[model samples]
Target chain A: MKKSINKIVMIGAGNLGTNLATAIHKSGYQIVQVFSRTSESARKLAKKTNALYTSSLDEIYPYADLYILALPDDAVLGFLKSKKLNNFFMVHTSGSLPVSVFKPFSNKFGVFYPLQTFSKNKILNFTDIPVCIEGNDKRTESDLMKIAKNISRNVMVLSSEKRKQAHLAAVFACNFTNHMYTIADEILSRKNISFDLIRPLIQETSEKVKLMKPALAQTGPALRKDKQILSAHMKMLAKDENYKKIYSFVSKSILSKTK
Target chain B: MKKSINKIVMIGAGNLGTNLATAIHKSGYQIVQVFSRTSESARKLAKKTNALYTSSLDEIYPYADLYILALPDDAVLGFLKSKKLNNFFMVHTSGSLPVSVFKPFSNKFGVFYPLQTFSKNKILNFTDIPVCIEGNDKRTESDLMKIAKNISRNVMVLSSEKRKQAHLAAVFACNFTNHMYTIADEILSRKNISFDLIRPLIQETSEKVKLMKPALAQTGPALRKDKQILSAHMKMLAKDENYKKIYSFVSKSILSKTK
Candidate 1:
């Protein structure tokens, strides 16, 4: 039987970090410490999780078995490189940052990437969230898996290279797709149309992908080769050069994929 | 009290048309007739709805109180322009096609655009879906509203111009967003990562926007202004110029919006 992850120390009380801390606490793990660049963030999360808070990195207590570097991907490496591991297992919850980031610091290096787009206000259901994990060794991997399984149901022991690829995919799936929503919102705002009108379709589009392959499920004027409607839409979008450019580019891309 | 819409005749059984027929049927409205250029499509929809189907445009039975032209935007104008009105209330379920398309056909001309992306296999909930309607006059508008309210809980009486803008927004929200999903799926496939991992994030990202403005809810390396991770992702995507361009474009776009 695997042992439970009793205590966890989260570094970086930003959106992902704060949410993860709360989720961990809710999952019955005790958050031993919360650290952030700002005192307010550290204190806020500490209050919520009943964990010790500190703005200073050196003041971090090594009471916990695991340390999660939930800072920005760039900051994660330097933060890891700056500190000596003190023989405790450390993992960075970053998609873009590599597992090798903690190589020089400790042999017990790993990644615990929660593949989800999170916000401070929105509570996420970690049950369905995919936890992509990696470790330098088998023991470290097993330890991280036990921790991950506690918080999330879906856990995958992926290699560092595979994690990198998954992160890149996340950029497209989460970041780029959100950008598309912003564009849609902007277009609606400009026309005095309510953004709420498109909300159902946006939700449905995401839901459909859960059951079907995106390629097989793709639909639009572009895929239909409706030159007339495309031309009319282009004419309608004549004033907005950027949107017109995007329409042409995406239409061409979808057509290429369909072909 | 509004009379129930029992008879619905659908013109142009393409993607939108076929789906609308299915939706109307599922919503307890009787699809009396289905017309299409292709015999196969008309037959398929007719079989699904248990309605009379015809390939010849002239053979369209005027059995329904409501005629829905789920046709291509341009085809709508040409089709309606040639037809003589027989006092039947007609509406084109189009976002781009102007209400003027129905001017020559009937004074009861209006629009019943169920603002959504519909595929044959994917079942949609009409209750939450917005039905953007417009009419040539007040009586027709009221009649159209009655029809819309019968199928959907959320119905809005939008002007022709507003519907056009909504269409543009739909392109951004539905069509373009789906394209982004396609891009994400492609990126993940190329990297040998299952697209399933990012599904939760994609769903959450949209769900977040329902309660919060997309600009405020957006969370990504791009919005965080993390240059290091951004550059790292760029480096990884160096070989794929298309993805690289998209990353840079969307990152810049999102940052601009938040700023």
Candidate 2:
């Protein structure tokens, strides 16, 4: 078996791209080139990975075995349209965009979506992270799997439509859930309570769902039909009509589910 | 200092009561007696803890040093009204009720609130759990702290009103957050998508808030003002008014905060 994929090129040196480059480099892959709209970001990542950095896509090294477009979803298609090339294997690390966007560029196209929210400073463990991969062909699929497996222990092949559904779910699970936490923070701050008070409960709620289906694991005043507590909470959130609506809507949903 | 509080007499065997008794027993404390309204539940927990069980409050052993009242908020006052006790340090593990609830029964009254959600099968780590304690006097505070420190590393003496506020925050952080997960589960299930797909993202959202304030850590299409994606999600949830309202309200709240 081949030990690893050696030559790689990365576009967009933002959070996801930088983290992916760092992980790939740490796994002993040679990052051949780095391209970003910003020279500073590209140069910083290049210096860390010992890769050649260029602001221009025209200066990109063409010989790299795998090229990754880690730009935003809207920007990815534009970047692909401008760069006219590639019989080589290429993939985008996006959860929402369709895989067929690469159809115009290369036959050896796929997706390498690491299903986790990435931020600039947060260092994530890729070992257990689900890397959803899909390829245009069998050989490309095999190659993507091999590379994905090298960087992560969990990898699965999912169709583009399924990946799109997963992205929608990710929005609810990660992004929307974080918004709920922010709501809690705001509510607590207004009442002069520390956010630390809710940290353990948040951790346990997540941990519980891992053991049971989230629906079965669900518990609260809503599920228990504790109208007193529910009304009290609603009154507390009265100033924020948006939060009040969420509180009532979710409570009713939970009540319906339990019934 | 005594290495452990050996003889524990639990005064209520409801959800919190049974769970806390089991946790304390598992942590090597001897649960000497289980007291509750229902003999069946008391016997069930007593059998698990190898302790004597009784439904009659008068049958409770007078020798136990630590008495935990884990009954419902409304029931605590009634339980105290019925029980005549003296010379024993009593702690009610509740976030909402005041320490004065136990003042009529024992001068050594304190609150020993385990700041996490509890269920029958879900075993929790007491070491990392924050125990919010409040005492009527210094000796009671010291006794409660000693007991709390035995089970958990993090313990704080918060006022009863502050603890009430913390409980209110918990409604948002734990209860309402889990409700969001339920909504997400329902959304995916309706789409014929597996909830497992969003598990990683759900876990990451909670984990992220541990390191950064949820307000600073917020991210979503809402924060970016990506009306296209937001509209797409809303359309998908259009048939379900509950979900549509939730999506719009939460998105607007997040966007307002970002601005």
Candidate 3:
């Protein structure tokens, strides 16, 4: 592979990879090849980026300087085991995994984690997503930052530890919050109440967080410690042990934090 | 105060009461009196709505067409105990409380629960709030619906049973979701990370729910059943018992829901 980190090879055609590659290609960067174990998936992303598709590792283009292993954590680790390719500037887009996972393979390895959840069908505006960059060398760092900064308005250089911590926070903010919505859907559906009723409140809650701290933005019965209503809600979820436990646990947690 | 439903007497100037009264006043209704056990609170709301303020029960306006007992459920019940209401169309704003709680005091008793979380400083656009109306008589129900519909775009005529169920759902959608944000804030702050990083994600998650079922919109390690990342997150939160318990419980709940 060339020493200049311009022509790129992308590994993986998953949600994150597809979005990342598409964004990178849109930003006037060259995406030369897209590789996935599944040929259809590889072709899907490759076609969008106008890159060659391959299901075989041996078919990975040799001239690309930037090799993005935007694969799953285990896949990234497994790929590392093969002692792959030239001394290219390689990186993985993982939240929990440390950047050091690349140290053994290349002299300049890095993390280019996109701090946003990617789903199959959604088209997220790149400007709104935060890109987290970490690297083993300044050259790698700057190159990765150039790519990330090119694609997103929000870019932060966080250590793997800090990135991992941020990822944990995201699980709470995004994952747990989505689960709460799912639970709300379950409760309302059982009662024939549409989820449409609460979407405004949910969106407002998020909008409030933008203007103030989430701690300050927090509200609802739990913050007030309205035990009567809390108990009544708990009773309403009695048939579902998971829902009941979640309700009490989060309500008490909010009370503890606010108090 | 007059026999016409144009005049309203607002009781208990708490968050809901304050917002409810303001929305009603803005919709061209005359708020004759704003009452609270605390003179300061009553005065605060009264000044905003151009209504008279009073702390004493005996000073309540005698002829207002509608009396909104916007107090806590217990306070609402307590007010009903003293037989203090004049024969005005009385209603209490409570989610879980039964509408019949006012039946003993007035022949035209009803419930006017706005199904949205209210805060002291936030200006809620009543146009987005879903007001739930229940009444002892058709006239009371219609009157409550007229006022609710005038101020808000969403109105539901639900019985106490259905309102309670929706209230339970609201706890999950609004209360639990806010707590999730709180937990995310705590996690990030411990590492000195700004909560700003997650705000966009939170907003997007909520927005996704508006277009699709929350169950379909759900993403993250929990839904993917990524055991490694899940365990890693749980370990990251191991120091805080509350967080650890919540992480595991909610993760399992999401897993179950997705499966």
Question: What tens-digit string does per-residue lDDT give for candidate 3 at B65-108?
Answer: 88998887767777888777845679889988998777667788
lDDT of 2 by residue, B157-242 (tens): 98987787677777778777887777777667766877777787788888888889987777667876877678877887778877
Off by over 4 Å in 3: A1-4, B1-3
Residue range with the least summed lDDT across 10 consecutive positions in model 2 chain A:
A80-89
Order of candidate numbers by TM-score, starting with the best = 3, 1, 2
DockQ of each: 0.67, 0.54, 0.77
Which should have the higher TM-score, number 1 or number 3?
Answer: 3
Query: What's the C-alpha lDDT at position B100 in model 3?
Result: 78
Which stretches in model 1 have alpha-carbon errors above 4 Å? A1-5, A84-87, A235-242, B1-7, B26-29, B62-64, B81-88
Per-residue CA lDDT of model 3 for A98-175, tens digit only, reads 988877777878999988777757867798798999989787788888889888999989999999999988888888
Counting clashing residue pairs in each candidate, in order, gives 0, 0, 0
TM-score of chain B, candidates 1 onward in order: 0.90, 0.88, 0.96
Q: What are the per-residue Cα lDDT tens digits for candidate 1 across A1-259?
A: 6454588898999888888899889888889999888999999989989999999878888767788888887787678666644567788888877787676778677888898887766657688899988889898888888878988999999887888778777887778777778888887888777778888888888888888888876877888787877888899889866667677778877787777
Give the range of the ten consecutive residues with the poorest summed lDDT in model 1 chain B: B79-88
